[model samples]
Structure formats: C-alpha cells, structure tokens
Target: MNSDTPQLKSFRSFEARQDGDRQTSRSESYLRTGRESSVISATIQADSTGRDMSIDLDVSADATHLKRFVVSVDFGTTFSSISFLILPRNTPPDSLDPHILYHHIQTIDHFPEEPCLGLAESRKEVPTEIWYPKEEYLEDSIMGDGTGSDDSPEGDMPFHLQNEDEENTYWGYEVYSCQRIDTDPNQNRRMGGFKLLFDESELTAQIRLDLEPTLDMMKKKKIIKDREDVISHYLKHLFSHAKEELSEKHEYTNDCPLGFVLCVPPIWTPKACRIMQTNMVRAIQESGYGSFGNCIDNLFIVSEPEAAAAYVIESTTTVLPKEAFMLLDAGGGTVDAITYTVNQTCPLRLEAEGVEAGGALCGSSYLNKAFQEHLSARLKDEDYLERNGISIRSIVDTEVVKFENNIKRKIDIIRPTSVFEFVEIQDLRADPRKNFGRNRLRLTHNDLRGIFLPVLEKVSGLMERQLELAKMRRINVTKVILIGGFANSPSLRSFLKRKLASIKSYQDEDIPLWARRRFLVPSSEPSTRETGRDASAVQVMDFDVMNRSILMTSLLTGESFPIASLWMAGST
Candidate 1:
C-alpha cells in the first residue's frame, strides 16, 4: 500500500548561538542566514543535551520534475461548490533521443519541436449535487421480454431518468435536489443549517423527540410509517436510483471511479462524523463510485473550513516567516477557526479552534421563528377561527396541492414581521405566544441585525480567547484571514473590524509583549462611529499570507525542506 501521509515541510531550521543564554526571556534568536555548517554542528550538539526535545515535519519536493494541484470543495448541507488549483512543474527531466548522426529531422505530424508544455489548472467552484434514479418494471400484461410487468412488485416504482447520452448520471447537485425529502417538515426542519429543535446536550437521544411531531404529520399524509421508516425508505429509494443511474451512465460498469474530497463541519464529533461518513460512503457506492461495493480509496474528507483555507491559502503569495496566524473561515454551514504555522525547519502546524456559527442560517432561523410566532398570534386573535377551521388532514387526504388555499397557504399562515413593527411591538411581542403567533409579520433589516449581533459576539469572543492563548505561548500572529460566503457580508466585516480593534486597543500592563507585537490594528474605522483622530499606525491587510511569507522565509533559511532534510539527516 502506498503511504497516505500528507507532505509536510518548513522553511527554517533553528540553531543555538554561542551567546545564547537559557535565562533570556526570548527563545534563541534564530540563526542568521548564510551560516550553514557552523549552525548545523551547533544544532546537533544542542540536540545531544539532556532536555525537552521536539521535531518539525517540514516537507518539500525534490529538485526532480513534479506537479501539484489543490482542490477545494465548498459543500453545504443544502448546496455545495468546488474549486481547484494546478501547480507549475519546476523543471523537466533530461531525456535522450535516438542517437542519429544526421542532424536533419522532419515529422509528418506537425508536432511542435518545442517540448510539450504542461499546464496546471485550478478550478474554483464545484457544485455539490448528488442524484439518484428510481427503478422501473414492465407491465404485468407485457407480451415480450421480462422488463417486469405492472403487476410485479418492482413495476410500481418510479424509473430512474436517463441522461442526455442515455447513460444514467449521478454525483451532481441536480440529483440531490430532485429527490424527495425523507423527514417530516414538522420533525426535522433542517434545510442546510437550521435544525428546529437541535440541543447540543443529549445529542442522539432527543434528536428523534424533536423529529416525532413532523413524522406524525407526514404519517398522516401516508408518506411513511414513522420518522425512522421514512428516512430508511428515502435512503433505500435514493440508493437504488443512484446505482441504476451509475450502471447506465458508464460503459465500464465494473469500473466506477470518482475522485472527491468531502468537507465536514468543524464541530462535528467523532460519532457524528462516523455517521455522516458512513452515510456518504453508502451514498457514493449506490451512486456507483464504490470499488468492490464500498467507498474507500476514492473518498477524502476535509473540514469545510479547511477546504476554504486551502482555497484561500493557495490564492496568496505572502508566506509567513513565523508560519503562525489565525485563520477564520466564515462559510455557509458554519464559521471555523484554525491556526496555521509553517517554519523552514518544521512541518506545517495546524490547530482547529471555535465552532460553526457563521452563515445565513442563524439569520434565517430567527426569521422563521419570528414568522411562526406571527402565525400563532393571528390564529389566537381570530378566536382560533383560522387555525381551527383549516384542516391539514383535508389537504393531505384530498391531495389538493393547491397553491392559493391548500397546504402552501396553511404553511404560510404565519408571516415574519419587519424590524419597524418588531421594534414597535417589542414589548408586546416579548410575550412569545401573542407576537410570533400572528400572521402578516415582516422582519426588517434591523431585526436581522439584532438577531445576528449575538452570533457575532460569540465569534468575537472566540478570537479574543485565541489571541490570549497565543499571547501566553509567545506566538506572534502576522495576519488574520477570513473567507467563505458569510465573510462577503459588509456588515459582518465592519462588525469584526470594530471588535478586533477594541481587543487590540487593550493596554493592560499585564498583557504580554508577544500579543502586543502580533496585534496589527485595522486601519478602517466603523462607519457608525465618527473619529477625528487616526488611532494607531499598525497596518492591517487582508490577502494571501502563505505566499507572501514563503520567499522571505526561504531566503532566511539557506535551503528548502528537501535539501535541508537530507543535509540535516546526513550530518549524523
């Protein structure tokens, strides 16, 4: 089996100076550049000392010709996207042609005499869509072959749709959207990030309790027996459809090969991760990407935030000398925080921090809850006339599916109120029952802002905590990078700038110098606050830090990872 360990490399190696003192507040000043043999011997001698020791995993490619590509997939619960990067190959290997004394050479094929140019391509967007097809059987009265009869058990199922080429297609986003939702709307109100009744505590157990009401509602409609049964049936249907599509789509039915990297949420627990991975593997196999009836080698899992990080990191030219900086990924599913550091002598170091709270979900959730409250209130004000008279059963029983007066209207009974009205009825609406229950509610921008404020606060607190931790460890942060769909919000950026500035402004004497040194006060001020005086000189910038620091640190260290590794190990 091939080794799957990812490449790790750093740019610098540290050596103790003759003047180095243990009592000094700082770690040994890193070795000055251009001093090779002298520093290497000193480092080796220092390593022999009886003390705490550590190793770095700096990885680098050899001088040999090679290519690299980075792929980023922005996958959300409801939607997904993909991006890719193709790296430039450094140098082509020397090749020998048939030694002919005659120098004259002419080819009928107008192949360019110049070497074939290799191009590295990077894609920035891949949609996250998976589709499956329903199976079909022939009519029982069929006079010919056994495509199955209408009276046969399999005949009644929906047949999978054939692709344009008459091959079945799966693994795209279109397929996922067309499938029937398995859970009851009342039970698992999850559309992307909004889980109506998700409580962190009692994770698995109460999940069903929260789901039962919706399941019951669906059961009434004869969608499925219970919530469990509904999901199972839905999965079975999807799996069957995917398999059929896969079988029909490709010419080589035995070879279903797909290359993919999945992005999961940062806060996902091991158990949750396992469940999700299992489901994904099953889905992939059913979709025909599995080898030997299983999904293994073809699948790779990276956190959604990490995928964004990889995407953004590769886009930058600035590399970090210290190789340490806070990474904030504000994406659709969640906001993830990570600290990444790379030094000449050490392997890439990464640590994940924070939770998933960034995106439109929180905003949308607040809106949905507000709307529900409005509907309930309207029902009460009308002497429960609307709620009592409108029969969900009748709609399901008759399968009316009417837009004006059927299920859609019933679902829409409760409307969300605007911020203007929300503010006007703030006190009145404080009574949860009367406010959110009524219909005809519209949430204004202010309401949306108010709902998002708390979430922003949580994110701010997390960053502050991370800074404090780094200060304790004497790690200097050079830049703070943010990416993802939510990061595109101007309001969010402004809010973060203010909060970060406030944190940086802390002048407490007890604060460590490392923290102060790392703080780069943002130049932009909050639009809401008027300031006559420019506060600090710290220049704040947002861009690709990895590429920026690379050259600088590479110069600082005499050689790159591959060369240094051989030299470092060969010395002993």
Candidate 2:
C-alpha cells in the first residue's frame, strides 16, 4: 500500500507519461491518445498469499470523452443511494471550480416501481429490500409478455425485466413499505440487513443454518445463483436505474463513457473489498448500460470515511492545512473512525498513513433494534395480548420503528428535561380505552436517553480511543468531522460535543476548549435550487455529496492513488 511499492511504480509510470507532454495538460492528454492509452493498470498484492492481482482501470477516459459522468454508489446495509457528477468535456480538470462541481453532484431520488406491486415512489435513498414472487405470479411475471422467451430484446421489456425472467426480482421502497402479505409464505420475504454478511471471513454452522431459507429462496427463484449473487442482483438494479436517470433526466447519450466510484467502510479487509468489487463489476456488466470490459475499466473503490473527509475539506471554509482532524462515519450498519492530517491545501492532500483507526457494529440500526426490544418489554402483558389478538413484535415493527426513525433526529439533546410524546400508536388498536393511558405512549427524558445513549456512548468511546492514539503519536488532533445518515442525530452530536469538551490531558491544564479542539458538521444549506421530481433532501452532508468529493479526489490524485494508504497497509 506504500507509494514506493511496485504496484505504485506502474502508477508513477503513467503519471510520468502524462506529465511529459508539454503541449497538453494532464487531463487533456487522454484526448490525444487513443482508447488504449486511456487504460491504466495497478496491481494489488494479497497480504496473506502474496499473490499479485492486476486491476485494469480507465482513469483518463473522463478526459478523452466528449461527455463523462461519475456515478457514485453508496451501498449501505439498510439503504442504498446514488449520485452523478457530469464532467463536461469543455472544462479542464484543474480549472473546474468546486462550486460548479457541487452543482453537478446531484442525488438520485426517483426509483423504479416494483414489478409485482406496481407501486411507484420517490425518495432520496431506496430501501435495500427485495421480495420473491410466489410460484404462480412468478410464472406470469416471467412469461406475461406473450413471447415467453428469455431471448427477447432488452429494449422490448420494462427496465427491471430486461434481464432473464428467472433472474428478475422486485425491489425499492414499495416492497418494504407495503403491508405484510399473508396469503403466500414466500410472498413478502424482505431481503436486507445482509450486506455485512459478505464481510465475514467465515460463516459458522449456525449462521449458515440461519441463512439457509433466504439463500434457498434466492436460488430457487433464480434471482441469484450464490451468496455473492445477492450483491450483484441489488447492484444490477441500482446501476440500471442510474443509467435511466442519466438518459431521461440529464439528457445523456450512450456515447458518453460512464465512470463509477463505489464507497465502502474503511474497516473492510482487502479481500472483502475485492469481493464487493467483483460482484459490483458483474452487476455493471449485467446492467446493460455498457460493455462489461468498459465498465470495469472505469470502476474504482474508495473508503467511506475518506470520502467524507474529502467532502468536508473541500466544501467547508473552516478547515486549515497541517491541522489534524478525525472523521467519524456513523452509518447505518457500522461506525468507522479515522484520523487525517492535512498535508497540503492547494491540491488538498490529507495524509492518513499510519494513523490508528477504530470502528464497531454499534450503528443507528442497533438503536432501532433496542427500541423494538424496549417496546416488547413494556407490552408483554399476556392478558392484554390475548384479548387484543395483537403481537408486540407487530406493533413495534409497524408503529414504534416509524416514530423512532422520524422523531429521533428532531429531539433536542441540549434539553435533558424535555419529553417526547408518541400518540401514533394509539390507533394501533380500535379500542382506545384498552391501550395504555388513553391510547398514548409517553417517553420521558430518561426513556429517550436510554434508547440512544448506549450506542452513542460506544461511538464516543471510539472517538476517545482515536484521540488517545493521536495523542500517543504526539499529533495534536484539533477537529472532528461527522458524516453519514446517523450523524444527523442531534442527541449524538450534543453528546459528543459535551463529552469531548470536558476531557483534559494531565499535562495541559490551561489549554482553552476552543483552542484545544473543535467539532465540525456540514452546513444544512441546500447545494442547489434546481426544480425537479426528486429534490435532494437537505442534510449536514448528503452521502452522495461525499461520494462526488471522492470522485473528484480520484480524478485529481489518479486512479492508482490510495486514500489513507499508509494506515491501510499497516492495519490488521
């Protein structure tokens, strides 16, 4: 992973060739050379096996094509999102303004309707859920178009149905948001929360047993042939939808070569990343957007935290050079933390080599699980359950989870005395009087604190450990930048600010709080005022924006440039 290694030597060779041309700028060099020269190759040496794997990349294609776009996919455990950055052929890479770049990093909000349910919806991120059709409906869906042949032209059928009938599956928010169907056992088995399973080095006997049913369903329906196929299936749909968006909304033609930058957790091993990349490549190939060879050549992988740091450094006006800062990516499935020292400001180099990194599975999804458990305990009355013919699990899943997802972000963590009222559950049962206290569930300050405190504490502990490591290295960490969906939690922000502010080193008694350190969050300002079907949701930092920043970094640093290379090489 070091820059001096043989793998990087190939990268350096490519850079040298690009720099040798005085007549053309580095970005313009691709225009003079043919498609063959646009291709760049890098080798990845496996740590355990010492096998060198060659990765062919077309990093300079953006410079060659008349129109190029970088499609960034932030594939998460609970939700998945996509964004697009159009690199206009006329604009030089170095001359491209940051403000203009932000304008092109548009979030994809609209998603295709489910084939089975025929329901359409628009949202910022699609729920990473899929449903298997029953045998009868499956046949009808597969052969409904009269031809009933798998060889039908892809253009003839619906976008989702372009693939082989057997491989076609239903997905999107409608699949998960729809009411539970009880008619068929396989009618609505939602497949999600399985993204992390791929990262496990080995599956235990019990784990394999638990996953049998889902795996069998996937295989039986011909939706996927194997475990890795699940990712391929999901990504196929995602890439297809993104292509449709670009064509219809952005007026992109097929002549434009598309580049992709996929974001993954920093904690994932090289093998895990390779597995993801392999499946994603298969997905892009099957998506029919372009040839498999061309798509794979343009693909790149980036760390989520590094991408977040890139966005913060470029978008925010407060960050300064040579200052050490920590980036905490509090995502849905995992929390990843990494410290970066700004090495340069002009070209923006944040060196994260040899820095200690920390992470845990205690993400926002766990808080939802905790809330479900809390509700179950409170509603565990046998008599009440029997009379109402209602299950605690159903109430929590349908009612309590919604409240937690929507209201938790709005809660003011500064005011500990405040209480959150939940009257949404009162209508769960027809008999309002039979429910708890006039069909209302009250959550005291203590209850609210209890729900999120444990997870937040774990995150806080991760930050503390990272800070301690920075201190041990004699690196003065001065700022913390929070990103990802879960980082929007007011309670989590308030907790971190309060907890980190009080700590003092044994040697520094007189250091002022502001001078010692600070916490930075992306501004809530909207990036653009473009009117469209799916207007981007305003947040501190949209995951898509971070993704675009990563894409920008890749173009500036070259395809062979590794983010946090030193740390990744040194990490276990």
TM-score against native, each model: 0.42, 0.66
Scored against the true structure, residue 560 in model 2 reaches a CA lDDT of 14
Candidate 1 local lDDT, 1-572, one digit each (tens): 22111211111111121112211422221121121233233233323322222223232333111222222223342223322211222211111000100011100111112111223211112222222222222123431221211122112222212344223333322232222232112212221221212213332334446556655654454333322222222233334443442233212133322333344454544443333434444333334433423232233343444333333333233444345556665433334455655443121223443322332232212222343343344334443322433432222212211111122212221134342332222112333544352333344444444445665666556666666666566666555665443444444555666666645412332211111100001000111111112111111112122121111001110000100000000000
Candidate whose TM-score is highest: 2
Tell me the spans in candidate 1 whose CA falls farther than 4 Å from its real position: 1-209, 212-257, 266-274, 288-294, 304-307, 331-334, 344-446, 505-572
lDDT of 2 by residue, 158-224 (tens): 2134334434356765554442222223433557665765555332234445666887875576444
Worst 10-residue lDDT window for candidate 1 reads 558-567
Residue pairs clashing in model 2 are none
Give me candidate 2's TM-score against the actual structure.
0.66
| Candidate of highest lDDT | 2
Candidate 1 positional error at 230, Å: 8.2
